[model samples]
Target chain A: METELSKRLGIEHAIFGFTPFPAVAAAISRAGGLGVLGAVRYTAPGDLARDLDWMQEHTGGRPYGLDVVMPAGKVEGVTEADVEAMIPEGHRRFVEELLTKHGVPPLPAGEASGWRITGWMEHVARSQLDVAFDYPIKLLANALGSPPADVVGRAHDRGVLVAALAGSAVHARRHAEAGIDIVVAQGYEAGGHTGEIASMVLTPEVVDAVGPLPVLAAGGIGSGEQIAAGLALGAQGVWLGSVWLTTTEADLHSRALTAKLLAAGSGDTVRSRALTGKPARQLRTEWTDAWDDPDGPGTLPMPLQGLLVAEAVSRIQKHGTEPLLGTPVGQIVGRMNSERSVRQVFDELTRGFERAVDRVQRIAGRSAS
Target chain B: METELSKRLGIEHAIFGFTPFPAVAAAISRAGGLGVLGAVRYTAPGDLARDLDWMQEHTGGRPYGLDVVMPAGKVEGVTEADVEAMIPEGHRRFVEELLTKHGVPPLPAGEASGWRITGWMEHVARSQLDVAFDYPIKLLANALGSPPADVVGRAHDRGVLVAALAGSAVHARRHAEAGIDIVVAQGYEAGGHTGEIASMVLTPEVVDAVGPLPVLAAGGIGSGEQIAAGLALGAQGVWLGSVWLTTTEADLHSRALTAKLLAAGSGDTVRSRALTGKPARQLRTEWTDAWDDPDGPGTLPMPLQGLLVAEAVSRIQKHGTEPLLGTPVGQIVGRMNSERSVRQVFDELTRGFERAVDRVQRIAGRSAS
Candidate 1:
């Protein structure tokens, strides 16, 4: 099951997991796939330091990646004061009214929850990157855009491979020109901020745009079949995010886990900007529907939107609001109906991919010996 | 190269071509793939009958399919007068103005160019279906929706297999329930009318939705890597549209053919309602730009939009307006950069698919013949 991409990263397979849980990340790395910890919520220097320390101690010295939310384009220097002013009163009122309607209670007074405000600032991301350098990280990935020259330079200096997720071929070229080590072609079916392009069209285009640069296909990739499809499309490997959300080791709340379980099919998720200012795909919840209404108050830009919805989400998560809570996930959430451990999920992926390869080869009238 | 789909269709390969070019369709059928003639333009019974007669006489009695545009939903009986009246005066004026600004000339009076009006009506589609039944057609496919029960029954009576193109898993289920023999999962990157879903997500979902029915992957599929990806995603075959537009057998105007050649990359196409009043992907042109303009008059719905753009398109084609004249094509138009023959395209697809199968099998640590 070793691929060129896995060999380069010193892993058993090219399956890379992007999870918010360090335990899941460590498990993936330990099982011989590149486990990438979602570092957006870990923007605090102290918080990130402790998390990375835990990952290092738990993963038996295996290599892992960290995904930071460093958007390539954003307004600079807008603080909490500015973000509050930018958000319309109607939008703020709408969030408050909906949370109250959904029976989500207010947080205790004099105790500001860490999840109440957004950590989406580029400065915050830079701080997280600063923390990542202290650890023995093998890969540094940016979800929304190409890393800045300083970040790229510093990572290269530290001998850490840089990867950037792209929704189209043009963006992939930008990553390549920025001296990135890998181009992750993320398609529309992906959970986070995604472009209108799909993986089948985007993967090969990115590969063609940045030849010789390793490409890990993201979006709608959960099983071996999709992995085979990505590889056949010239992608070096597959980077998965949503499939890990429902796994046993995922640190999702009970409400979020329940929502993921009841997803009717792949068609259940909607790509909306409600959760994070950017159009990140997630399960259709009341919170999303209220914000996504075309005639209703529109959303603010990234950090501002994040700031506006953060408290509401924490309330919903804390109260275990039935239909008002959801997690950032991809269209692949439909297939993640049952709960399984990290080891079981990894084994399923590898086994399915092996079976798919064998099936195609047998169809080609070839023998697998 | 033989697949269960091709074996059932009695073809050498599981590749299907959807084109209006009789030469191209006949050639694809002659070369061991299903060649489907686009019958939306053949509203007149006499015209459709003649085309089928010509096809039967030309292809050495080889089997070919007819693709009729029968949308699942439409107005019952709207006459030409009702359609004309429903179109706003400003929208009509915008069409006339855009065509005149592009230097397209009007047709001579009484010449009655065949391309003056759209044949997207249910009545028109029914007439085309009537003609399809009269021929020895092997397959009957509906582009916009599932075939009517009566139409399905009639096709079955004639031993013709029925297929429908779906943009989602839900649509695939409807088609299967309607007694469709096959389902074609068309993705966003496909030319003509498409849905928001991409092939990677849509293909597997549709395959899962319609258990036993054959599924053909379409949209953004022009290469062998894509073909292999389709097969891996569980499609029995691949349906190609835009790739054939650039082939030598395509009877495209000299100007349109040249425009197809200059398409820089896959990013050159846009999915807009300007062409058929539906969100179909096509090469970007001034004609599309004017209709896509938000400040200008908005597009009319369905048959009305088709009625409005029909004459404008004919004038552009006749005048050979390079920048204004464009063809219905997918994002794969970027890869359709060169002028290739039908045989070459088919040969390349098969060879590429075989090599991809071998490559994946080897990566899986399996033996390939």
Candidate 2:
């Protein structure tokens, strides 16, 4: 399961496990794969520093990475107040009405839990990066697009590799031009923001577009067989996100949402713009349906959309509204039917990859490897 | 590449090349793969009879298949006129206005083209099947759903294997329960009518749902590596549609449409109900865009929608209106950039499959076979 990229990164497998939970990230790193901690949830720099410190201790000197949602250009000067003021009254009224219709109560006073738009601000991301550089991070990945040139240079200066997620060949070429070390070719079936291309088409296209640069296949990849297919499609490894959500090491903070995810089928997920301004694949809930209703107001742009729904989402989680409880998950959620330790999942993936290799070899008229 | 299904079918490779042209179908069979000709375009039973006779002579005794669009229940008593009478006047005017706006003129008198809704009617499908049984067709496949139990029985009685396209595990289970010999796991990125699940997720799910019964992986499979990936995902064979659209053996009739497909990228295709009452993937054109417009009258259900647009589509092709000309295709159109003989394409697929197998074997810590 190892590739040149894995060898360079000092990891044992080609699996890149992405999680917002530092515990899951540390566990993945300790289990012989690169674990990348997502920084979008850490609004305050000190919170990210605390998690990294914890990860540093728990990972047992194993390599781990950090993921930041940095827009291609500078995202400075736009304050949270400015983003809030941009939301229309009609949009606000629609959200309020939607909550009322669903009988969802407001969040308790002084209990803040939903997303903070300021986390997406450039200053906040830079502060998180500053704290990240203080630690021994092996890789830095951008969620939205290629990071700024200066950021890439700074990461390289610290001997850290830069990676970016691309949903199409065009975007992959752009990342290659930006000197990103690895391209995560995330497809439409991926959680969070994704483009129209599926991994079957996008992986080969990206690999062809940037031959020398390694590509990690992502989206709808849960099993070890999918990892083999990714490598078959010329990807150096597989980048998985949703599969980790059900792992014992993950702390989703809501048991109700976890139950819903376990019971969902592949068709249960929908790609909607309700989560952020961009189209993102998530569990289809009454909340997403309401946003898609023809008569209802459409979703607002990013930062603004997140701002408007942050409280409503918190309330939905607080109340455990069965129909509205959901989290961003890929179509692979259909197979994440039970909870398992990160080590267990990792072993199964390796076994599946081996079986797939033997299967393909036999099919090609050769004896099973 | 051989599988149990391919071995039983007496084909050299586990590739199911689906095309609407008899020439392409014959060439695929001669190239050591199963060629399944789409029977929906044959309005006259005699025409299908003639093509089957031609296929018999050209295939050199190699195995081929026939695909019919038969609904689960009987579709008796539905004439083309009856279906036309049910279309709303608003919808008719919308199509007329769209054509006029695009400067697409009406079809020349008596030069009837486009689709015939009657071809989808039960009587027509049965007639086509009756003519098909006279030939040495090795497989009988239904495009929409599992053929009625009697039809499956009839195919089995004739020593023909029956296969049905299923978009989900539930649908695959139904097909298996109906005693269909094979299930084609068609995914969201497939040409023509497709469900929401992409091949990466759908293939494994369908395979898991129905084991011992062979599954053919379809959608976004245009290369040997994808075929290898499909086999890795547990499918016995790969079913392809869009990849053959540009093959030298295919006769698209309209050079404009063929040129459009060759020049298009994977992202250029869209899944819209604008073609039929059901969502079908096709090359996105101004015609599709006009139907998708927010202000336009929404698409009608299947038969009526096909009836309303048939003449307009004929007109668009008749006039060679560049912006309005398109055809059913998959996201794999991105790679169908050149025209080649069916044998050439088959050779490339085999080579690519071998490369993928060797690559996976190497990655799995075994020396390349």
Candidate 3:
């Protein structure tokens, strides 16, 4: 199950479990795959630092990574008030109408807006990176695009690997040019923000384009057979995200967990811009559908869309309406119909990977003989 | 390059080139891979018979297959006149306006509509199947869904292997249950009509779901490396369509040839329903964009949409305008930037497969030693 990339990263296998839950990350690391904690939701650097501190205590001295969302071309200088003002009145009315239609009750006056990323900006991501460097972080990944050259340099200076998730070979080249240690070629079949290319086509292109730089295939990969496919596509490793969502270690809303487990199919998710002002793959629900209505105002760009929908998401979450509730996920959610421990997932991935390798080797050996 | 599936099929490599071009199909068969001629464009059984006869003459006795598009659930009992009456006046106006804006000349009165697919009906496909069975066809493949049970039975009775292209594991299971000999799991990244899942994830799932039935990976696969990836994902073979488009043997129109070579990229295609009444991946063009416009009437379902757009397509092709010109293709068009003979393309595929296997072997050997 081990790969050259895994040996280099000092892990038992080249499996990366990226999740917002610290417990899941720690559990995955304990299970021998490098677990990466998604730090974008932690608005404050102190919160991320504390979460990492908690994660480190449970990881049994194994290495883990931090994932920050800093899209290379985010709009700057727009204050929250300014961005809020940019959302049209018609969009607000549409959202209110959609909530009524879906039977989602309004939120209380003083309830929190729930977990949302404010680290989409470069400066905010830089603050998170500073906190990450203070810990024993072995890797720092940029989820949306290539990290700035200085960020890559800073991580390299401290012996931490700089990884970037690219939706295309063009983006992968940008990462390699900017001194990224690893390129995660995230295909359209992946959850959240993804490019149009599929992992089967994109992984080898990224590997060839980067020329010796390690490539980690991502998107539509939740099984060991897929991991072997990634390796065959010239990827040195694989970076997985949504597969961790239904694990026992994950912190999920009851409605979301139930929805994912019972209702989600390979075609259940859609690449919609409603959630984050970007085309992110998520569970297709009435909430996403209403936002995409032709008669309603179209979605705003990234930060504005996220900002506009924060309260609506909060209300939806509070009401626990199945039609209004959703989660970011890939088509792989079809295979994630049951809950398993993080360690159990790791075992399956490794065992399945070994079996796939044996199959390939048997074929190769027969040919050679 | 040989796979157990290929050996069973009596081929040198586990490669299947599915193309509408007879020369390309025959050339692929002559070059050691099985060639499957797409018969969706064959408006009549006689047309398919004539084409298959030509292919047989060129194939030098090598086994070849026939591909017919018969999606599982198309509306029946609606005549061409009945469906033509269903198209809205606004959609008709919009198509006319788009063509007029592009300066496309009107078609001469009573020239046959450039595209016709009355054969999408079960009876029509059955007629084509009878014609196919009369020939030396080694296989009969349904491009869109599980073939009718009787169609599968008829193929089996005639000593022809039954195959079906599935976009999902659920579809693949249906094919296996219907007695399909092979399941081609086509990913979203593939050209033409594709399902939402990526091949990296879908191949293994389809292979597992189909049990002993052979699985051929399709979508976003143009190179030998991708072919290796398909096998690694548990597919017994790889099925390709768009890669053959740019080959010298392809029967592409001049504008289409230019569009594919000069403009199509991995990201330049969109899954638009403007063509064939289904979400088919095609080279993104102003024609597709106009049809997807929110202001315009949304596309009608299958045969209706195809019929509605036929005249518009005729004018566009006649005009040869770059913005309106398009072709069904996969994201693999990024790699099909040059014109090679079918033999050259086949050589590259097998050579690349060997290189990828050697790379995998070296890594596996290193770990073992």
Candidate 4:
């Protein structure tokens, strides 16, 4: 389970765990892998700073990183209200009708819905970055590939390693040319935004495209055997996201959603644009089906879609609608059958990885003899 | 590369090479891997008998197999003209308009379009099987999963091992229960007929589902490293289809198709129902796009779609229409960048598999030390 990535990142294992919960991030770091706290949920700068403070206190001097969902540009001065106004009335009505059809109750009075779009705004993302550098953070990752050149320079100035997720070799080469310290070769089976290429083809292609740069294989990887396969495909390490959703430390916001995830199989997931206005792999729900229907009004673009669906998503989670409850998850959700502690998952991963390596070695040895 | 599959199948390498060409099949058996020739193209029983005779003379005492594309049922008395008449006039006009729009000329008066339907009828497949048993074929495979129980018993009676392709653990379990000797876990990235699950998730699931039954990992496997990864994922061996399309023994019908495959990348392939009325992965071309267009008359069901498109496909190939010419291929086409002999491909796969195994062993060894 150890490789150049582990040595370079000063971790005991070559595993990078991505989570939005600070508790999970701290637990992952405490368990010997780099724990990346997703910053998209922390729309306010102070909220992110508060989480960083908690991570600093709980990580036991272990390294932790932050992930921001910002596009590559110098975004400035656009407020959430401006983006909110861009959503069309027809789209709003379509969401209301669908939610009504599904019998999802509205939120209680004075309970504001979740705000995920603000963090995607360039200025809010920059503000989050400004707060992140104040902590002992070791990595700054851009969810939508490489951040602006100036942003990379700023992270480098603060001794932070810059990484970006690429779905193909073309994007990986671009990230390398943009001076990214690492490339996360996320494949079609990944939870969030992904391209059409699967990991078996993408990993080797990215590894060859970005020669000498560390590549972490992502998507369709849940167990240690898959991790071993990732390494066999020439990746320096592995990055996992959806497997953590069912961990004891994860705050999935609903018990029903957790139950749904546990009962799902690999075939239960589907790639749809309903989640984030881009093609993202998630559990197939009535919500996704409605959006994908031929007669339904099509989904809007990024920030606009997020703005339109924010309240509907909140209502679904709040009410725990059985057929409508889901989160962004990969096909590996099939293997997340039960709840386990983060440390226990790591133990199984290392053991399984070693077993796979030993098995392959024995086979190869016998072949040669 | 030694596994229980290699030992039981009595092959020198744990590899199954699938091709439609008799020459490629003979060469694969000569190279110590099992070559399963696709039998769906042999509509006439006499044609299949001639090829089986050729295979017997050229296999050089090595084992080979045959794959027939017949559904599990008793099919009789249906002629190709009956299936052809079932196609609607609107669909016929669509195909003709599409070819004319592409400037593809009509075939010379006496040239008949290729016939691929008769073999899919169970009676034709049974006749092909009758001719096949006359040769020393060691394996009999059903391309569309397990054939009828009677067919399975018949193969067993002939001392031939029966194998079938499965796209999910549920399907694998069904195949195992039906007395299939081997299960081929074909994944989403596979060429031609495939399931939605990728190999990384499908292989281990099938292996666990059909305990003690051998599973061969297919899809996204083109190189030795992928083969090593497949074995690591708990498969007894690897099943490869697309990589052979560019091999020297492949009769690709036209130089144009060969050049298209050589220049394509992993992202160039798309899974569309434009072919065979089922979702099959193939190189994206204008022909696929025209069928996939929302404005066009939708594709018909199985044998009908095959009937509707056969003439258009022949015209495209005969004219060497650059934008319209394509074939069934997997994402692994990204790696098949050049034409080489089957022996050369096998040599590279073995070396790559060994190197990957050695590399993982070193990492595990260092971690343990």
Best by TM-score: 2
| Local accuracy of candidate 2 as per-residue lDDT tens digits, B212-278 | 8999999989999999999999999999999999999898778888899989998999998898889
By DockQ, the best candidate is 2
Collision count for each candidate, in order: 2, 1, 1, 0
Looking at the true structure's interface, with contacts defined as alpha carbon pairs within 8 Å between chains A and B, what fraction does model 4 recover?
A: 0.71
User: Please, what are the lDDT tens digits per residue for candidate 1 over residues B67-156?
Assistant: 987776667677888887888888888878887777788976765555635467778888888777878888999998887888899999
lDDT (Cα atoms) of all candidates against the true structure: 0.82, 0.91, 0.82, 0.88
For each candidate, C-alpha RMSD in Å? Answer: 2.8, 1.2, 2.9, 1.9
Error of 2 at A125 (Å): 0.5
> What is the per-residue lDDT of model 3 for residues A1-369, given as tens digits with 9 covering 90 to 100?
466878878887788989999999999999988999998777788988889889879999998999997766656686667877988888778778888888877677776777564666677888998898999889889887787777778888999998998888888888888888999998988998988898887898888899699999899899887887788788888899999988888877665656555558888889999899889999988778877877668898867888778878877877777777888899888889788899888889877776766666555544331
Ranking by DockQ: 2, 4, 1, 3
Q: Report how far off residue A312 is in candidate 3 (Å).
A: 3.9
Candidate 1 ranges beyond 4 A from true positions: A71-104, A113-118, B71-78, B100-103, B116-118, B254-261, B284-297, B321-324
Off by over 4 Å in 3: A1-4, A71-78, A89-111, A121-123, A253-259, A364-369, B44-47, B71-79, B88-90, B106-114, B119-124, B362-369
Give interface RMSD, every candidate, in order: 1.5, 0.7, 2.1, 0.9
TM-score of 4: 0.97
* Worst window of 10 by summed lDDT in candidate 2 chain B: B74-83
Worst 10 residues of 3 chain B by lDDT: B360-369
lDDT value, residue B287 of candidate 1: 78
Per residue, candidate 2 scores C-alpha lDDT tens digits across A83-103 of 789899999999888888889
